[model samples]
Target: MPLQPSSAGTWLRAVLLAGVVVLLVSLIVAIILGASALTGGKQESSPKMLKWKDRGTTRNLQEVILGRCYSYVTAHYPELRDKDCLKIWESLKHAFIYKNPCNITAEDYQPLMELASHPIPCNKSLFWSKTNDLVHRYTKSNHNFLTLEDTLLGYMADRISWCGDPSAPGINYESCPKRSECESNPSSVFWKKASKMFAEAACGVVQVMLNGSVETGAFRSSSIFGSIEISNLNPDKVSAVQIWLMHDIGGPQSESCSGHSIKRLKGVLEERNFKITCEENHRPVQLLQCVNNPDHADCRLCSSNVETP
Candidate 1:
């Protein structure tokens, strides 16, 4: 079957065209399969990667930090106007990023602490335990005292939660470990470190507002105030530790100036060679609490209690 040269050439061209079509089809199939695999992986991993243990890592963490930093330097703390917010954020990031949520230590936040530190004026420090709301209210109204939360180091992250992961995205947006779950969690570590610094810097006469209504008494050996702040206080700089035992207006007073806990606190201070003073229902703070409960007996003026004929 000898064929013409032109016919043989046409037959060869048909075979080449068929081979090209097969190669193109195989390439398209491979691309589709690869894309599908990537998408499926992302779908399978989304929840686990983002899951949290309690309230997840705070959303918009970077934005919130930057905003707070700028606001602090520009408004709340004009003295810190020269601070680099970006650098502060970077310091915070490096401390916890790619680290296990349960393993972050107080030392990890040292860089951030240094970046945000400022001198707390003497005699203006106000420490509190179990009286968060009232203590803050007293500070706002008095303007003569400042709590740790009022300072630059605490102001930037107060009332917010945040944590990191050892994986990609770095931060877990689902939840962070509770303080009880991980004592060394990022938030807990930060406050412990911050509280220590605040206590150490306090000088002259300092105030501590404690809740007298706490059943366990006003002072606890485990509290930040008792544990971190108390140990860090310098007797040479501090003339006295003024303790204000405040109870809710018209509320049951479970503890007092002479309660077992108060005596223990006194012992600690005396052992440390620092003068201590205790005042139950400190007048100034009591007056502030009475603003909303003017009718309460505790809020009534002593003169109004005079016996009638």
Candidate 2:
């Protein structure tokens, strides 16, 4: 004997099954959505964190520039007011903002150069290659020579890296391309432009300090001094180029006044129709070294010799 089910019972069972199927589908969809949200969150958070960190550094740079400008002008250039400092900062910003960090060229900085440009006194210009620390110390201690870094703009921007992002409104401090990585990077372009201006403004006699201990010798055709500054020197304006061949206190002198490389540099200057002179261990440089290291035997000899280069 078989018993027949009631219509209501059968209808109820169908309804219950449909509801379970719908619930299962909804659960699967929710799980998928939850996973997607977590993945998207991870992907977006990294760049945001990087951007935030970089933004802070960039703001710090702005403050540093303003402070350096104020300090430099107040101490050395009293004629320039705070307003002038503001103007300089604004001009500097306009040079590289809203551009590709790696694509900025020296020409792009022309406006800033013109805005910050000031006259460098004749015969006071000092240039150097591979002698950054010594040259800066010499220039600072003896105020008679003015290196490119002595200028207002150069003083403010030295040893800092800054570049712009086309997507952002400000500097790309986090990932600015290095000078070695990109020739047209903002830092390199700036130095090139500034060096050119410095060189062009050089008049009368300009003293250049070159490293005698370097295997490349006192002059490298690739250095900023050799490639940019030397070529930019106006023969009519500059009477002579004095080369100071600096060496280590110890021996192993690779280059000197008569080294082939020195001769080549001399020939280059003479071909440019400018009077050229070379001296090994120029007196002022040796004197400064002696003052820094009084006990070294070489320093003692330097102090005893008062001969001019």
Candidate 3:
């Protein structure tokens, strides 16, 4: 026989129906949360997109070139005004823009070089091989001496790598060919052209700071100083080449005035009819090194000797 529903049975059926609804709602909420978690994980792992306008390479090129130009002109070259700085930037840009960076040669920078060229005072020029830091410090301390980097163009571009991509609209900040990777890379070409100009301008008793610690001979023929500067020095213009052989105070004095490398350098100068003079452990450079390390034995020796090259 069919059974009639009681109040208790009816209540039990209603309770079961409510429980199913609640469980379904809970499962839907959990699935939504899991999808959100997965999306967040993907976002965190993905690389960020860089906007073209916000590229650091382009911004740095503009700011540093412009700022350095202003400071350099104001301090050393009063003849150049603000307009000249803008011209310099424009000229520099013309060298590699719309061209393959690796294909750029020293000839490509001729326009820029011509525009940026300025006279370096006679006997004020300094050159170096494997002694960039020390030479720069020496130049900075001694107002009488100037290096290629002290000039406007070199000052703006020193220690910077820049290149352009033919396929791209602007400078390639993401990557650039290394000096060893390409013969005519933008950085190498700039320095090569600049060094040639600097060497050409050298006059009177030009100074050269060479590293005494170098095992391969301080004056390598392949170096910028040897290849570019030394070759370009006009015997008629330059009266002498003063070699400052700098050695570390601690020791390992590998190359010096009597070393084979230095002898070769002297021979090269003499062949060109240029008088050569060399001094070992050049005092000014040693003293500068000592300033940072007064406690070192070398610094103590420097104080007693107190000589200049």
Candidate 4:
């Protein structure tokens, strides 16, 4: 077998080359298995693994917020023209970014609220319960009344859904949690904090528009208007609470100014030592509703024969 030295050297080199090929194959398999384990055998995350289930975060959030803030300062409240819209956007982002969506607290929004704070003049604050559309329409047509949406803080973030995640890009665009899913949901917490601030700043005579047509009654103690706004109103600043209990133009009136719910509201205000006034189908509000149903019975001129308490 020791015939030739050149032949023996060639055979040894062939053996070494075969061993290197085996080693390279093992390394490639190890790399692939490690990557699979890291991602749980999936190339991308499943939708079922997303944090929220209701709706995804709003698209173009930054642009929309900045636009609204600038518009509000320039067109609506020019007095706030000095405010830094960019800083406000930053504060809002800081409140929920890279955090648990369900764990965001009202305190997280404190900076944003403070940054957007402004005075609500006397006799202009308008609160509403179960009368969102009518109240907003009324406020829009009659500039004297200002709802939460009319304010700088609410204006910027109104009708938008947003939440943060512990993942890359920070915000979870797949979905956002509902208030029922978690009490500290970012949107709910923000609105609660903003509503509280709005209520506290209300001065002079405040107005509240309630839907009397609802079978559940016009006022609920659990509502933001009931739980937050009415409770936080300053007795020293606000002289009275004027409640306009409105009913649908063509719908039945389930709760009047003298209904049990109205009486309950009256009792609450009295207990808090704030003067109260109640009017059913407030003429101005009813008139606005009439615009759409001009041919309906309730839209007639005689509909102004409203009940009062």
How many residue pairs collide in each prediction? 3, 0, 0, 0
- Report model 3's TM-score to 2 decimal places: 0.77
Q: What TM-score would each prediction reach against the true structure?
A: 0.86, 0.78, 0.77, 0.86
| lDDT ranking of the models | 4, 1, 3, 2
Position 304, candidate 1: lDDT? 15
lDDT of 3 at 227: 85
- Candidate 4 wrongly placed segments (more than 4 Å): 1-49, 302-309
Error of 4 at 254 (Å): 0.6
Candidate models: Cα lDDT each: 0.86, 0.79, 0.80, 0.89
Off by over 4 Å in 1: 1-47, 50-52, 302-309
Which of 1 and 3 is ahead in lDDT?
1
Q: Write the per-residue lDDT of candidate 3 for residues 175-217, one digit (tens) a residue.
A: 6777666677777788998999899989889999888888888
| Model 2, runs deviating above 4 Å | 1-59, 303-309
| Residue 213 accuracy (lDDT) in model 3 | 89
For model 4, how does the per-residue alpha-carbon lDDT over 1-309 read when each residue is reduced to its tens digit? 564998989999999999999999999999999999998997876333246677878999999999999999999888889989999999999998878898998889988988988889899999999999999999999999999999999898889989988777888888989988998988999999999999999999999999989999999999998899989999999998999889898897898888998899989999998988888888989889989999998777735334434
Per-residue lDDT of 1-309 in model 2, one digit per residue for the tens? Answer: 444668778988999999999999999999888887988845343222113221222457778888998887687877665436677778778778877666887777787786677888898999999899989989988898999999877898877767787765456656666556667867778898899889999999999988888886778889898899989999999998888888877655798688888888888898899887777888788888777677887876763211122
Better of 1 and 2 by lDDT: 1
RMSD of 4: 3.9
